[model samples]
Target: MSFRSRGPRTVPLKSAEEVDAIVRKIRDDQTRPENYRERSLKLHGWICAKCGREFELSNLHLLTVHHKDGNHNYNPPDGSNWENLCVYCHDDEHSRTILADYLAGKDKKS
Candidate 1:
């Protein structure tokens, strides 16, 4: 039996409005403050600042951006407030802060 040749594949076209919307969405996403994670990683390299743990793309998710001042909205473009922390180290750092607050009576029920 002879094999038949397949025809060229056809793609659906989007309207100009749809294309414009897609471009605007991409631009907004690029400008969002949440991108600080990427900026921090680039500025600090792929190592945990507290534990000195290195990360590769395969395990990058284990690395996280920790804000120095405990403010999620305080991301600065200069990378002054960000540190890359491995999940374990980041948890320990926050736990220490909580423990300090508890010991200092900051979390009193009054």
Candidate 2:
């Protein structure tokens, strides 16, 4: 006897409405900000891209996802725009962005 004869194939059956609901739920979850962060962490691991600091599970919460283009809604499944950064580096990145915007505005007035 082969492996195929050892057991029957099993398939899950669902109504059309049920399948639609499941698909909608999945899409909704994927669009959430938390889901993007989780995906980023998984894609890039727990090292801070900016500071080169590594984290363990105990300190993983200190690590955050940074959107390279500064758009939170631009998350891609391939994590092309995501960077894992520790809290300090993340804050520094945002601070630089803020300063740059302010300087640009000041320059526009001159």
Candidate 3:
């Protein structure tokens, strides 16, 4: 007597055209800077994520949306890639990222 064994079915990969379409859709979605900022503000409110500074409607312009992973083209629908930062904190955060990269390069060289 012989027993038959079942194997996992393989899923079909996306065609090149389908992949390109998906990439274009993602790029279009992420390139909407204004929409992401509005959605981030709605998700995180008027408080700065870094410094906890609060903004009122009169000064809401001071609040800016920062891309957490440093990739401006990675905006997700859940606002996971965003943080609301006051202008000062946003500047500082970028400065820190630059400094960290420089230090890492120096360490690698050493």
Candidate 4:
């Protein structure tokens, strides 16, 4: 008997409402900024920079863009904020920043 693999199927386009929900989800503070999303995807291969794992768009629940300088207000006018980063890596970057600051403070106290 011959075996047929179902493989994968493409779903129909999302309804307007569904799209809106996704937009709102991405707008959350933890998500990468919209203006920079596409750019980040291109730069980071749509993968988490920290983990080096590839992810589908649907699986990008925690994918985010991070500013190295820690200055959200300095977002350039040209949409440079887009820097694809996987969830774990993005969190690590931010966490590392905080930890460094904390250690520095402790050092001062010492």
TM of each candidate vs. truth: 0.75, 0.64, 0.63, 0.52
Best by TM-score: 1
For TM-score, candidate 3 versus 4, the one ahead is: 3
Q: Which candidate number maximizes lDDT?
A: 1
lDDT of 3: 0.93
Clash number for each model: 0, 0, 0, 2
**Each model's RMSD to truth, in Å?**
6.3, 13.9, 17.1, 11.7
lDDT at position 79, candidate 1: 92
lDDT of 3 at 72: 97
Give the TM-score (vs. native) of candidate 1. Answer: 0.75
Q: Model 3 segments beyond 4 Å from truth?
A: 1-34, 106-110
Q: Which candidate, 2 or 3, has the higher lDDT?
A: 3
Q: What Cα-based lDDT does every candidate model obtain? A: 0.94, 0.91, 0.93, 0.71
Per-residue lDDT tens digits of candidate 4, residues 1-110?
99999989988999999999988987884575555566556666767666778788688766887775667666664546546677778877878877998887853654
Local lDDT at 7 for model 3: 81
The better candidate by TM-score, 2 or 4, is 2
Q: In model 4, which runs have C-alpha deviations exceeding 4 angstroms?
A: 1-34, 76-82, 106-110
Candidate 4 lowest-lDDT run of ten: 75-84
For model 1, the superposed segments whose C-alpha errors exceed 4 Å read: 1-16, 23-34
